[model samples]
Target: MSPHSSNDGGFAKAAGAPAPQTIVTDAEGLDAALVTLPGGAPAYVARPGEGDTYPIVLIAQEIFGLHEHIRDIARRFAKLGYLAIAPDYIIGYGDPRTAPDIDAIRAIVVRVPDAETMTIFDEALAFAATKGGDPSRAAVTGFCWGGRIAWLYAAHNPRLRACIPWYGRLDGARTKAQSRWPIDIATALKVPTLALYGGADPSIPLELVEAMRTRLKEAHAPAEFIVYDGAPHAFFADYRESYREEAAKDAWARALAFLRARGAG
Candidate 1:
Protein backbone atom coordinates (compact mmCIF):
# COMPACT_ATOMS: atom_id res chain seq x y z
CA MET A 1 0.00 0.00 0.00
CA SER A 2 2.73 2.41 0.90
CA PRO A 3 5.71 3.02 -1.36
CA HIS A 4 7.96 -0.07 -1.76
CA SER A 5 10.32 -0.82 1.10
CA SER A 6 13.60 -2.21 -0.20
CA ASN A 7 15.03 -2.88 3.22
CA ASP A 8 12.15 -4.93 4.51
CA GLY A 9 12.10 -7.44 1.66
CA GLY A 10 14.30 -7.89 -1.47
CA PHE A 11 17.74 -9.33 -2.05
CA ALA A 12 20.71 -7.51 -0.60
CA LYS A 13 21.97 -4.87 -3.02
CA ALA A 14 23.86 -6.40 -5.89
CA ALA A 15 27.30 -5.06 -6.70
CA GLY A 16 27.10 -1.76 -8.63
CA ALA A 17 23.32 -1.50 -8.43
CA PRO A 18 22.07 2.06 -8.54
CA ALA A 19 20.88 3.48 -5.27
CA PRO A 20 17.20 2.73 -4.88
CA GLN A 21 14.86 5.49 -6.08
CA THR A 22 13.46 7.74 -3.43
CA ILE A 23 9.67 7.74 -3.06
CA VAL A 24 7.80 11.06 -2.86
CA THR A 25 5.51 9.59 -0.24
CA ASP A 26 3.13 12.54 -0.15
CA ALA A 27 2.76 13.00 -3.87
CA GLU A 28 -0.72 13.02 -5.34
CA GLY A 29 -2.10 12.07 -8.78
CA LEU A 30 -0.87 8.45 -8.63
CA ASP A 31 -2.12 5.99 -6.05
CA ALA A 32 -0.60 2.56 -5.32
CA ALA A 33 -2.19 -0.12 -3.17
CA LEU A 34 -2.52 -3.85 -2.51
CA VAL A 35 -5.51 -5.92 -3.56
CA THR A 36 -6.44 -9.49 -2.69
CA LEU A 37 -7.56 -11.94 -5.34
CA PRO A 38 -10.63 -14.22 -5.06
CA GLY A 39 -8.76 -16.89 -3.11
CA GLY A 40 -6.75 -14.47 -0.99
CA ALA A 41 -3.86 -13.95 -3.38
CA PRO A 42 -2.16 -10.54 -3.07
CA ALA A 43 -1.24 -8.05 -5.79
CA TYR A 44 0.20 -4.55 -5.99
CA VAL A 45 -1.72 -2.03 -8.08
CA ALA A 46 -1.03 1.50 -9.27
CA ARG A 47 -3.30 3.89 -11.15
CA PRO A 48 -3.34 7.47 -12.35
CA GLY A 49 -5.61 10.05 -10.72
CA GLU A 50 -7.22 11.38 -13.89
CA GLY A 51 -8.65 8.30 -15.47
CA ASP A 52 -12.17 6.97 -15.03
CA THR A 53 -11.25 4.00 -17.18
CA TYR A 54 -7.75 3.22 -18.42
CA PRO A 55 -5.85 0.65 -20.37
CA ILE A 56 -4.47 -2.11 -18.18
CA VAL A 57 -1.02 -3.64 -18.12
CA LEU A 58 -0.17 -6.47 -15.77
CA ILE A 59 3.48 -6.44 -14.69
CA ALA A 60 4.76 -9.82 -13.59
CA GLN A 61 7.57 -9.66 -11.08
CA GLU A 62 11.07 -11.06 -11.32
CA ILE A 63 12.18 -13.99 -9.15
CA PHE A 64 12.43 -11.53 -6.30
CA GLY A 65 8.68 -11.52 -6.01
CA LEU A 66 7.01 -8.20 -5.05
CA HIS A 67 10.27 -6.46 -4.26
CA GLU A 68 10.88 -2.74 -4.55
CA HIS A 69 12.10 -3.04 -8.11
CA ILE A 70 8.93 -4.86 -9.19
CA ARG A 71 6.74 -2.34 -7.37
CA ASP A 72 8.58 0.46 -9.16
CA ILE A 73 7.77 -1.18 -12.48
CA ALA A 74 4.04 -1.19 -11.75
CA ARG A 75 4.26 2.43 -10.66
CA ARG A 76 5.99 3.29 -13.92
CA PHE A 77 3.13 1.81 -15.92
CA ALA A 78 0.54 3.59 -13.79
CA LYS A 79 2.29 6.90 -14.36
CA LEU A 80 1.97 6.21 -18.07
CA GLY A 81 -1.80 6.42 -17.56
CA TYR A 82 -2.49 2.75 -17.08
CA LEU A 83 -4.03 0.54 -14.46
CA ALA A 84 -0.92 -1.57 -13.75
CA ILE A 85 -0.98 -4.57 -11.49
CA ALA A 86 1.86 -6.81 -10.23
CA PRO A 87 0.67 -9.96 -8.56
CA ASP A 88 2.98 -11.81 -6.20
CA TYR A 89 2.45 -14.92 -8.26
CA ILE A 90 5.02 -16.73 -6.07
CA ILE A 91 2.37 -17.53 -3.50
CA GLY A 92 2.60 -20.62 -1.20
CA TYR A 93 6.40 -20.85 -1.31
CA GLY A 94 6.74 -18.04 1.17
CA ASP A 95 7.91 -14.55 0.16
CA PRO A 96 10.76 -14.69 -2.37
CA ARG A 97 12.18 -11.57 -0.85
CA THR A 98 12.60 -13.52 2.33
CA ALA A 99 14.74 -16.18 0.74
CA PRO A 100 18.34 -15.85 1.84
CA ASP A 101 19.97 -16.81 -1.41
CA ILE A 102 19.17 -16.96 -5.12
CA ASP A 103 19.30 -20.77 -5.13
CA ALA A 104 16.89 -20.86 -2.25
CA ILE A 105 14.48 -18.68 -4.17
CA ARG A 106 14.67 -20.90 -7.22
CA ALA A 107 14.22 -24.09 -5.26
CA ILE A 108 10.82 -22.88 -4.10
CA VAL A 109 9.81 -21.03 -7.25
CA VAL A 110 10.50 -23.95 -9.56
CA ARG A 111 7.97 -26.05 -7.66
CA VAL A 112 5.02 -23.81 -8.61
CA PRO A 113 2.73 -25.43 -11.17
CA ASP A 114 2.02 -23.55 -14.38
CA ALA A 115 -1.66 -24.40 -14.14
CA GLU A 116 -1.90 -22.62 -10.80
CA THR A 117 0.07 -19.61 -12.00
CA MET A 118 -2.14 -19.31 -15.08
CA THR A 119 -5.23 -19.48 -12.93
CA ILE A 120 -3.86 -16.68 -10.77
CA PHE A 121 -3.48 -14.55 -13.88
CA ASP A 122 -7.11 -15.08 -14.73
CA GLU A 123 -7.96 -14.01 -11.23
CA ALA A 124 -5.74 -10.97 -11.68
CA LEU A 125 -7.62 -9.97 -14.81
CA ALA A 126 -10.91 -10.30 -13.03
CA PHE A 127 -9.57 -8.14 -10.24
CA ALA A 128 -8.42 -5.54 -12.76
CA ALA A 129 -11.86 -5.37 -14.36
CA THR A 130 -13.26 -4.18 -11.05
CA LYS A 131 -10.75 -1.32 -10.86
CA GLY A 132 -11.57 0.54 -14.09
CA GLY A 133 -9.10 -1.54 -16.05
CA ASP A 134 -10.39 -2.27 -19.54
CA PRO A 135 -10.04 -5.94 -20.39
CA SER A 136 -10.17 -5.22 -24.13
CA ARG A 137 -7.14 -2.99 -23.84
CA ALA A 138 -5.11 -5.30 -21.68
CA ALA A 139 -1.39 -5.88 -22.04
CA VAL A 140 1.10 -7.92 -20.03
CA THR A 141 4.85 -7.55 -19.65
CA GLY A 142 7.34 -9.02 -17.24
CA PHE A 143 11.01 -9.40 -16.33
CA CYS A 144 13.19 -12.45 -15.55
CA TRP A 145 10.99 -15.24 -14.15
CA GLY A 146 7.99 -13.12 -14.92
CA GLY A 147 9.09 -12.51 -18.51
CA ARG A 148 8.60 -16.18 -19.35
CA ILE A 149 5.16 -16.14 -17.77
CA ALA A 150 4.23 -13.20 -19.98
CA TRP A 151 4.87 -15.45 -22.95
CA LEU A 152 2.68 -18.20 -21.49
CA TYR A 153 -0.05 -15.76 -20.54
CA ALA A 154 -0.12 -14.40 -24.08
CA ALA A 155 -0.95 -17.89 -25.25
CA HIS A 156 -3.50 -18.45 -22.49
CA ASN A 157 -5.32 -15.12 -22.60
CA PRO A 158 -6.85 -14.41 -25.99
CA ARG A 159 -7.99 -10.98 -24.84
CA LEU A 160 -4.47 -9.62 -24.34
CA ARG A 161 -3.63 -7.02 -26.97
CA ALA A 162 0.14 -7.13 -26.47
CA CYS A 163 2.82 -8.87 -24.46
CA ILE A 164 6.46 -8.08 -23.72
CA PRO A 165 8.76 -10.71 -22.33
CA TRP A 166 12.04 -9.28 -21.07
CA TYR A 167 15.08 -11.47 -20.61
CA GLY A 168 13.41 -14.68 -19.44
CA ARG A 169 14.86 -18.04 -20.30
CA LEU A 170 13.70 -19.47 -23.60
CA ASP A 171 14.50 -23.15 -23.07
CA GLY A 172 14.70 -25.16 -19.91
CA ALA A 173 14.31 -28.69 -18.72
CA ARG A 174 10.63 -29.38 -18.22
CA THR A 175 9.16 -30.49 -14.94
CA LYS A 176 5.65 -31.60 -14.11
CA ALA A 177 4.81 -28.05 -13.00
CA GLN A 178 6.57 -26.10 -15.76
CA SER A 179 5.79 -28.42 -18.62
CA ARG A 180 6.03 -25.90 -21.45
CA TRP A 181 9.03 -23.80 -22.34
CA PRO A 182 8.82 -20.71 -24.55
CA ILE A 183 9.85 -22.71 -27.59
CA ASP A 184 7.03 -25.17 -26.96
CA ILE A 185 4.42 -22.41 -26.93
CA ALA A 186 5.73 -19.95 -29.51
CA THR A 187 3.24 -21.06 -32.09
CA ALA A 188 0.41 -20.60 -29.68
CA LEU A 189 1.01 -16.97 -28.75
CA LYS A 190 -2.24 -15.11 -29.46
CA VAL A 191 -1.14 -11.46 -29.52
CA PRO A 192 1.67 -9.19 -30.59
CA THR A 193 4.73 -9.29 -28.33
CA LEU A 194 7.88 -7.25 -28.48
CA ALA A 195 10.35 -9.82 -27.25
CA LEU A 196 13.23 -7.96 -25.58
CA TYR A 197 16.31 -9.94 -24.75
CA GLY A 198 19.98 -9.53 -23.94
CA GLY A 199 22.45 -10.84 -26.42
CA ALA A 200 24.95 -11.61 -23.71
CA ASP A 201 22.92 -13.06 -20.89
CA PRO A 202 24.92 -16.08 -19.84
CA SER A 203 22.00 -17.86 -18.25
CA ILE A 204 19.94 -17.53 -21.46
CA PRO A 205 22.19 -18.43 -24.35
CA LEU A 206 21.82 -16.75 -27.73
CA GLU A 207 21.17 -20.15 -29.28
CA LEU A 208 17.89 -20.37 -27.41
CA VAL A 209 16.90 -16.90 -28.53
CA GLU A 210 17.60 -17.80 -32.11
CA ALA A 211 15.71 -21.04 -31.71
CA MET A 212 12.69 -19.26 -30.36
CA ARG A 213 13.02 -16.68 -33.14
CA THR A 214 12.99 -19.41 -35.75
CA ARG A 215 9.99 -21.06 -34.17
CA LEU A 216 8.04 -17.81 -34.09
CA LYS A 217 8.83 -17.25 -37.72
CA GLU A 218 7.82 -20.76 -38.65
CA ALA A 219 4.59 -20.39 -36.75
CA HIS A 220 3.94 -16.93 -38.14
CA ALA A 221 3.33 -15.66 -34.66
CA PRO A 222 2.73 -11.95 -34.24
CA ALA A 223 5.88 -11.19 -32.31
CA GLU A 224 9.30 -9.67 -32.87
CA PHE A 225 12.54 -10.43 -31.09
CA ILE A 226 15.12 -7.72 -30.52
CA VAL A 227 18.36 -8.35 -28.71
CA TYR A 228 20.49 -5.63 -27.14
CA ASP A 229 24.16 -6.09 -27.83
CA GLY A 230 26.33 -6.97 -24.83
CA ALA A 231 23.48 -6.63 -22.35
CA PRO A 232 22.87 -9.33 -19.78
CA HIS A 233 19.91 -10.59 -17.78
CA ALA A 234 17.80 -8.22 -15.73
CA PHE A 235 19.02 -5.28 -17.76
CA PHE A 236 15.81 -3.32 -17.14
CA ALA A 237 16.27 -3.60 -13.42
CA ASP A 238 17.96 -0.34 -12.47
CA TYR A 239 18.35 -1.59 -8.96
CA ARG A 240 20.76 -4.28 -10.15
CA GLU A 241 24.28 -4.23 -11.51
CA SER A 242 23.05 -5.86 -14.71
CA TYR A 243 21.06 -2.78 -15.70
CA ARG A 244 22.04 -1.39 -19.08
CA GLU A 245 20.77 2.15 -19.54
CA GLU A 246 21.05 2.17 -23.31
CA ALA A 247 19.32 -1.17 -23.76
CA ALA A 248 16.82 -0.40 -21.05
CA LYS A 249 15.86 2.95 -22.59
CA ASP A 250 15.49 1.45 -26.03
CA ALA A 251 13.42 -1.46 -24.72
CA TRP A 252 11.16 0.96 -22.86
CA ALA A 253 10.45 2.83 -26.10
CA ARG A 254 9.72 -0.39 -27.97
CA ALA A 255 7.49 -1.67 -25.18
CA LEU A 256 5.43 1.54 -25.13
CA ALA A 257 5.13 1.52 -28.90
CA PHE A 258 4.18 -2.15 -28.97
CA LEU A 259 1.47 -1.83 -26.31
CA ARG A 260 0.14 1.53 -27.50
CA ALA A 261 0.03 0.23 -31.05
CA ARG A 262 -2.40 -2.41 -29.88
CA GLY A 263 -4.45 -0.38 -27.27
CA ALA A 264 -2.63 -0.40 -23.91
CA GLY A 265 -1.65 3.23 -24.27
Candidate 2:
Protein backbone atom coordinates (compact mmCIF):
# COMPACT_ATOMS: atom_id res chain seq x y z
CA MET A 1 0.00 0.00 0.00
CA SER A 2 1.13 3.51 -0.76
CA PRO A 3 2.18 5.44 2.34
CA HIS A 4 -0.51 8.06 2.19
CA SER A 5 -0.91 11.41 3.86
CA SER A 6 -3.73 13.94 3.88
CA ASN A 7 -1.59 16.33 1.83
CA ASP A 8 -0.91 13.95 -1.00
CA GLY A 9 -1.36 15.10 -4.59
CA GLY A 10 -3.98 12.52 -5.48
CA PHE A 11 -5.66 9.42 -4.08
CA ALA A 12 -4.26 8.10 -0.80
CA LYS A 13 -5.41 5.24 1.35
CA ALA A 14 -6.26 6.01 4.96
CA ALA A 15 -2.94 5.71 6.76
CA GLY A 16 -4.25 4.81 10.20
CA ALA A 17 -7.34 4.21 12.23
CA PRO A 18 -9.74 6.70 13.89
CA ALA A 19 -11.61 6.44 10.59
CA PRO A 20 -14.60 8.75 11.09
CA GLN A 21 -17.05 5.96 11.95
CA THR A 22 -15.34 2.69 11.18
CA ILE A 23 -17.46 -0.37 11.95
CA VAL A 24 -15.62 -3.60 12.72
CA THR A 25 -17.34 -6.97 12.36
CA ASP A 26 -16.23 -10.05 14.23
CA ALA A 27 -17.04 -11.93 10.99
CA GLU A 28 -19.42 -13.82 13.25
CA GLY A 29 -22.83 -14.47 11.77
CA LEU A 30 -22.32 -11.26 9.79
CA ASP A 31 -19.63 -12.64 7.50
CA ALA A 32 -18.45 -11.38 4.12
CA ALA A 33 -17.78 -14.28 1.80
CA LEU A 34 -16.19 -14.30 -1.63
CA VAL A 35 -18.49 -15.12 -4.50
CA THR A 36 -18.47 -15.24 -8.29
CA LEU A 37 -20.70 -13.32 -10.59
CA PRO A 38 -22.43 -15.07 -13.49
CA GLY A 39 -19.40 -14.54 -15.72
CA GLY A 40 -16.91 -15.54 -13.06
CA ALA A 41 -16.27 -11.96 -12.01
CA PRO A 42 -14.99 -11.53 -8.43
CA ALA A 43 -17.32 -10.22 -5.73
CA TYR A 44 -17.64 -10.02 -1.95
CA VAL A 45 -20.99 -10.94 -0.39
CA ALA A 46 -22.17 -9.93 3.07
CA ARG A 47 -25.43 -10.80 4.81
CA PRO A 48 -26.93 -11.86 8.09
CA GLY A 49 -26.15 -15.56 8.30
CA GLU A 50 -29.11 -16.32 10.58
CA GLY A 51 -31.82 -14.19 9.03
CA ASP A 52 -34.18 -14.84 6.17
CA THR A 53 -33.62 -13.50 2.68
CA TYR A 54 -32.79 -9.79 2.74
CA PRO A 55 -33.09 -6.83 0.47
CA ILE A 56 -30.23 -6.39 -1.97
CA VAL A 57 -27.99 -3.34 -2.13
CA LEU A 58 -25.62 -3.32 -5.09
CA ILE A 59 -22.54 -1.34 -4.12
CA ALA A 60 -20.47 0.31 -6.84
CA GLN A 61 -16.85 0.93 -6.05
CA GLU A 62 -15.07 4.24 -5.88
CA ILE A 63 -12.56 5.26 -8.55
CA PHE A 64 -10.13 3.39 -6.33
CA GLY A 65 -11.86 0.16 -7.29
CA LEU A 66 -13.34 -2.47 -4.98
CA HIS A 67 -11.19 -2.35 -1.88
CA GLU A 68 -11.61 -2.77 1.85
CA HIS A 69 -13.73 0.38 1.99
CA ILE A 70 -16.27 -0.99 -0.46
CA ARG A 71 -16.35 -4.36 1.33
CA ASP A 72 -16.90 -2.58 4.63
CA ILE A 73 -19.82 -0.76 3.09
CA ALA A 74 -21.27 -4.16 2.19
CA ARG A 75 -20.79 -5.32 5.77
CA ARG A 76 -22.57 -2.22 7.02
CA PHE A 77 -25.53 -3.00 4.82
CA ALA A 78 -25.64 -6.55 6.16
CA LYS A 79 -26.01 -5.10 9.66
CA LEU A 80 -29.02 -3.18 8.38
CA GLY A 81 -30.70 -6.42 7.26
CA TYR A 82 -29.69 -6.13 3.63
CA LEU A 83 -27.62 -8.50 1.56
CA ALA A 84 -24.95 -6.37 -0.11
CA ILE A 85 -22.57 -7.21 -2.93
CA ALA A 86 -19.53 -5.28 -4.09
CA PRO A 87 -18.13 -6.56 -7.34
CA ASP A 88 -14.75 -5.86 -8.84
CA TYR A 89 -16.35 -4.68 -12.01
CA ILE A 90 -13.25 -2.86 -13.17
CA ILE A 91 -11.17 -5.99 -13.20
CA GLY A 92 -11.52 -6.39 -16.95
CA TYR A 93 -10.05 -2.94 -17.49
CA GLY A 94 -7.47 -2.88 -14.74
CA ASP A 95 -7.20 -2.96 -10.96
CA PRO A 96 -7.35 0.52 -9.48
CA ARG A 97 -5.56 -0.67 -6.36
CA THR A 98 -2.38 -1.17 -8.34
CA ALA A 99 -2.51 2.18 -10.11
CA PRO A 100 -0.28 3.96 -7.58
CA ASP A 101 -2.02 7.25 -8.34
CA ILE A 102 -5.35 8.72 -9.29
CA ASP A 103 -4.24 9.72 -12.76
CA ALA A 104 -3.31 6.14 -13.51
CA ILE A 105 -6.70 5.01 -12.25
CA ARG A 106 -8.36 7.55 -14.51
CA ALA A 107 -6.41 6.17 -17.43
CA ILE A 108 -8.05 2.81 -16.85
CA VAL A 109 -11.42 4.42 -16.21
CA VAL A 110 -11.37 6.46 -19.38
CA ARG A 111 -10.93 3.33 -21.41
CA VAL A 112 -13.64 1.28 -19.69
CA PRO A 113 -16.80 1.07 -21.75
CA ASP A 114 -20.03 1.82 -19.94
CA ALA A 115 -21.83 -0.95 -21.74
CA GLU A 116 -19.45 -3.45 -20.22
CA THR A 117 -20.00 -2.07 -16.74
CA MET A 118 -23.75 -2.24 -17.18
CA THR A 119 -23.59 -5.88 -18.23
CA ILE A 120 -21.26 -6.83 -15.37
CA PHE A 121 -23.57 -5.30 -12.81
CA ASP A 122 -26.47 -7.08 -14.43
CA GLU A 123 -24.73 -10.39 -13.97
CA ALA A 124 -23.89 -9.36 -10.41
CA LEU A 125 -27.56 -8.74 -9.76
CA ALA A 126 -28.33 -12.18 -11.13
CA PHE A 127 -25.74 -13.63 -8.76
CA ALA A 128 -27.26 -11.75 -5.84
CA ALA A 129 -30.67 -13.07 -6.76
CA THR A 130 -29.39 -16.60 -6.28
CA LYS A 131 -27.92 -15.76 -2.86
CA GLY A 132 -31.37 -15.23 -1.32
CA GLY A 133 -31.47 -11.51 -2.08
CA ASP A 134 -34.88 -10.16 -3.00
CA PRO A 135 -34.63 -8.66 -6.46
CA SER A 136 -37.83 -6.67 -6.13
CA ARG A 137 -36.41 -5.00 -3.05
CA ALA A 138 -33.15 -3.99 -4.70
CA ALA A 139 -31.35 -0.65 -4.57
CA VAL A 140 -28.00 0.78 -5.69
CA THR A 141 -25.59 3.33 -4.24
CA GLY A 142 -22.10 4.28 -5.32
CA PHE A 143 -19.36 6.76 -4.50
CA CYS A 144 -17.47 9.19 -6.76
CA TRP A 145 -16.85 7.41 -10.06
CA GLY A 146 -19.24 4.66 -9.03
CA GLY A 147 -21.75 7.35 -8.20
CA ARG A 148 -21.94 8.19 -11.86
CA ILE A 149 -22.62 4.52 -12.53
CA ALA A 150 -25.38 4.59 -9.93
CA TRP A 151 -27.25 7.07 -12.05
CA LEU A 152 -26.67 5.02 -15.17
CA TYR A 153 -27.75 1.85 -13.33
CA ALA A 154 -30.96 3.56 -12.29
CA ALA A 155 -31.61 4.20 -15.94
CA HIS A 156 -30.43 0.76 -17.03
CA ASN A 157 -32.36 -1.37 -14.53
CA PRO A 158 -36.07 -0.71 -14.44
CA ARG A 159 -36.31 -2.92 -11.34
CA LEU A 160 -34.18 -0.73 -9.07
CA ARG A 161 -36.37 0.50 -6.24
CA ALA A 162 -34.02 3.30 -5.21
CA CYS A 163 -30.53 4.65 -5.93
CA ILE A 164 -28.12 7.14 -4.40
CA PRO A 165 -25.24 8.69 -6.35
CA TRP A 166 -22.61 10.32 -4.19
CA TYR A 167 -20.75 13.29 -5.67
CA GLY A 168 -20.81 11.89 -9.17
CA ARG A 169 -20.36 14.36 -11.98
CA LEU A 170 -23.55 15.53 -13.57
CA ASP A 171 -21.80 16.19 -16.86
CA GLY A 172 -18.50 15.40 -18.46
CA ALA A 173 -16.71 15.21 -21.77
CA ARG A 174 -17.68 12.01 -23.54
CA THR A 175 -15.31 9.37 -24.83
CA LYS A 176 -15.61 6.31 -27.06
CA ALA A 177 -15.63 4.17 -23.93
CA GLN A 178 -18.26 6.41 -22.33
CA SER A 179 -20.80 7.36 -24.95
CA ARG A 180 -23.09 9.20 -22.55
CA TRP A 181 -22.71 11.19 -19.39
CA PRO A 182 -25.15 11.26 -16.47
CA ILE A 183 -26.71 14.43 -17.83
CA ASP A 184 -27.60 12.62 -21.02
CA ILE A 185 -29.78 10.16 -19.08
CA ALA A 186 -31.55 12.51 -16.65
CA THR A 187 -34.75 12.20 -18.60
CA ALA A 188 -34.38 8.46 -18.98
CA LEU A 189 -34.45 7.37 -15.35
CA LYS A 190 -37.13 4.81 -14.48
CA VAL A 191 -36.39 4.59 -10.76
CA PRO A 192 -36.11 7.05 -7.91
CA THR A 193 -32.55 8.36 -7.55
CA LEU A 194 -31.16 10.53 -4.76
CA ALA A 195 -27.86 12.19 -5.66
CA LEU A 196 -25.68 13.48 -2.84
CA TYR A 197 -23.01 15.98 -3.88
CA GLY A 198 -20.54 18.36 -2.33
CA GLY A 199 -21.08 22.03 -2.98
CA ALA A 200 -17.41 22.92 -3.13
CA ASP A 201 -16.17 20.02 -5.19
CA PRO A 202 -13.64 21.54 -7.57
CA SER A 203 -14.26 18.94 -10.26
CA ILE A 204 -18.03 19.43 -10.41
CA PRO A 205 -19.20 23.00 -10.92
CA LEU A 206 -22.42 24.09 -9.26
CA GLU A 207 -23.80 25.23 -12.59
CA LEU A 208 -23.69 21.67 -13.89
CA VAL A 209 -25.37 20.52 -10.72
CA GLU A 210 -28.10 23.11 -11.22
CA ALA A 211 -28.39 22.14 -14.83
CA MET A 212 -28.87 18.52 -13.89
CA ARG A 213 -31.48 19.48 -11.33
CA THR A 214 -33.32 21.60 -13.83
CA ARG A 215 -33.28 18.84 -16.42
CA LEU A 216 -34.52 16.22 -13.98
CA LYS A 217 -37.24 18.55 -12.71
CA GLU A 218 -38.38 19.42 -16.21
CA ALA A 219 -38.39 15.73 -17.14
CA HIS A 220 -40.37 15.03 -13.98
CA ALA A 221 -37.89 12.31 -13.20
CA PRO A 222 -37.79 10.81 -9.70
CA ALA A 223 -34.27 12.01 -8.98
CA GLU A 224 -32.99 14.57 -6.48
CA PHE A 225 -29.63 16.11 -5.68
CA ILE A 226 -28.49 17.22 -2.25
CA VAL A 227 -25.50 19.56 -2.19
CA TYR A 228 -23.72 19.95 1.11
CA ASP A 229 -22.36 23.46 1.21
CA GLY A 230 -18.58 23.65 1.77
CA ALA A 231 -18.07 19.93 1.48
CA PRO A 232 -15.59 18.68 -1.09
CA HIS A 233 -15.89 15.56 -3.24
CA ALA A 234 -15.93 12.11 -1.68
CA PHE A 235 -17.08 13.51 1.65
CA PHE A 236 -18.26 10.10 2.79
CA ALA A 237 -14.76 8.63 2.52
CA ASP A 238 -13.75 8.83 6.17
CA TYR A 239 -10.18 7.78 5.48
CA ARG A 240 -9.55 10.70 3.16
CA GLU A 241 -8.92 14.30 4.13
CA SER A 242 -11.68 15.32 1.76
CA TYR A 243 -14.21 13.69 4.08
CA ARG A 244 -16.82 15.96 5.61
CA GLU A 245 -18.05 14.46 8.86
CA GLU A 246 -21.23 16.50 9.23
CA ALA A 247 -22.18 16.09 5.60
CA ALA A 248 -21.40 12.39 5.62
CA LYS A 249 -23.57 11.82 8.70
CA ASP A 250 -26.53 13.62 7.20
CA ALA A 251 -26.08 11.86 3.85
CA TRP A 252 -26.16 8.41 5.50
CA ALA A 253 -29.31 9.26 7.44
CA ARG A 254 -31.06 10.40 4.31
CA ALA A 255 -29.86 7.37 2.32
CA LEU A 256 -31.10 4.97 5.04
CA ALA A 257 -34.48 6.64 5.06
CA PHE A 258 -34.74 6.55 1.29
CA LEU A 259 -33.77 2.89 1.19
CA ARG A 260 -36.18 1.89 3.94
CA ALA A 261 -39.04 3.89 2.48
CA ARG A 262 -38.54 2.04 -0.81
CA GLY A 263 -38.56 -1.40 0.90
CA ALA A 264 -34.87 -1.82 0.14
CA GLY A 265 -33.55 -1.84 3.69
What TM-score fits each model?
Answer: 0.92, 0.91
Task: Pick out the ten consecutive residues of candidate 1 with the lowest summed lDDT.
Answer: 8-17
lDDT tens digits, residue span 69-143, model 2: 777677778878888888777878887876767778888888888988888889878888887889999999999
lDDT of the candidates, in the order given: 0.82, 0.81
Q: Write the per-residue lDDT of candidate 1 for residues 125-199, one digit (tens) a residue.
A: 888888889999999998999999999888889789999999987888899999998789998877898999998
Error of 1 at 261 (Å): 0.7
Clashing residue pairs for model 1: none
Q: How accurate is candidate 2 locally (lDDT)?
A: 0.81
The RMSD (Cα, Å) of candidate 2 is 5.2
lDDT of 1 at 66: 79
